[model samples]
Target: MTQQPIISLRDVGVRYKRAGSIFRKTQYYQALKSINLDIYPGETLGILGRNGAGKSTLLKVISGILKPDSGEIINRGASVSLLALQAGFDPNLSGRDNAVLSGMLQGYSRKEIESKLEEIQDFSELGDFFYEPVRTYSSGMRTRLGFSVSTTISPDVLLIDEVLSVGDKEFRKKAEQVIIQKIQSQQTIILVSHSEQQIIRLCERSIIL
Candidate 1:
């Protein structure tokens, strides 16, 4: 029998209005137009597009952070998480606290999130910096924590938007290895990347925008 889709996008469209020049009227830009897709379980899918082609927009839509201007998203009880850098973190909170918060937002209780804290801390390799406020973190540090939390939570559907290249070489390698293990374990993933080669290497199927 055929597998059922964990998430489905039906005739979805997202538009934004941009300010125009002094003489020109404001214009509406369609970030995503009439999108129709079925994201099945345990499949690694790649979205390939140029910088302005809405790859990030699609991930945001799928992650429910952005509502489409038109059509419907049907999520059949699947948990989706975007491995977004510096996302869902409170600048005033410590990275350790933020990790707990991020997990709770994804439906875990405090105890559950706390139980995984040590693994998250070890994987991030933040050392003492993990207890520092997020506002003190550099981009690399943020990436490390974000990646660690996202991976540890183990959401049913993972959305990765070009995050593998944000860290130092060693950290990047480690992050890639974690993703590889998830892939091997049949995790459902939606990856958006500018590098076609990377997409081809990681994804079972891909679509070009």
Candidate 2:
């Protein structure tokens, strides 16, 4: 039997207007144009594109963070999560508090999030810095916290946007291992990356935007 798509997008398009001063006219750009795609259960799809190619835009649309100006999206009521550096973080909150908040946003109870706090803390490896406010964190520290919190909850559909590009070699290896395990467990994923090798290795089907 053939598997059905968990999410369907048809004739999708997004538009953006460039910032302009009073003397300059604003120009509009089509971020995505007449795109049609379907994301199936337990399938890993890779999206390859250069800068400004709407790769991140596409993922954001699917994750419900951005609304397309045109076309329709049909999601089969699956829990969706987007894993992007600094995407869902608050600069005023500490790493620990942010983890709890992110979990709550993912539909987990506060009690459950608290129970997983230690695991999130350990994986992030922020140590005492985890207690400090996010404003005190470096870019790498923020990435670690965001990644750890997002991965703690296994969503039905996960969208990853260039998050692997951050962190040190050791952390990147650990992150790749985690992704490998998720793939082994047949988790549905949509990954946007500029690395063609990564796309080839992790995805059975891919598209270039």
TM-score of each: 0.88, 0.88
Off by over 4 Å in 2: 19-26, 86-93, 134-138
lDDT of 1 by residue, 1-209 (tens): 19999999999999988878889999999999999999999999999999999999999999999999999999999988887555578989999999999877766799999999999999998999999998999988888898888777678998998988878999999999998898888889999999999999999999887
> lDDT scores for all predictions?
0.90, 0.87
Which pairs in model 1 have colliding backbones? none
Tell me the tens digit of each residue's lDDT in model 2 across 65-176.
Answer: 8999999888999878787444457889999889888888776899998999999899999999999999999988888888888777788988888777778888988988
Residue 173 Cα positional deviation in candidate 1, in Å, after optimal superposition: 0.5
Query: How much lDDT does candidate 1 score?
Result: 0.90
User: Positional deviation of 90 in candidate 1, in angstroms?
Assistant: 4.0
RMSD of each predicted structure: 2.6, 2.4
Q: For candidate 1, what is the TM-score?
A: 0.88
**Candidate with the greatest lDDT versus the true structure:** 1
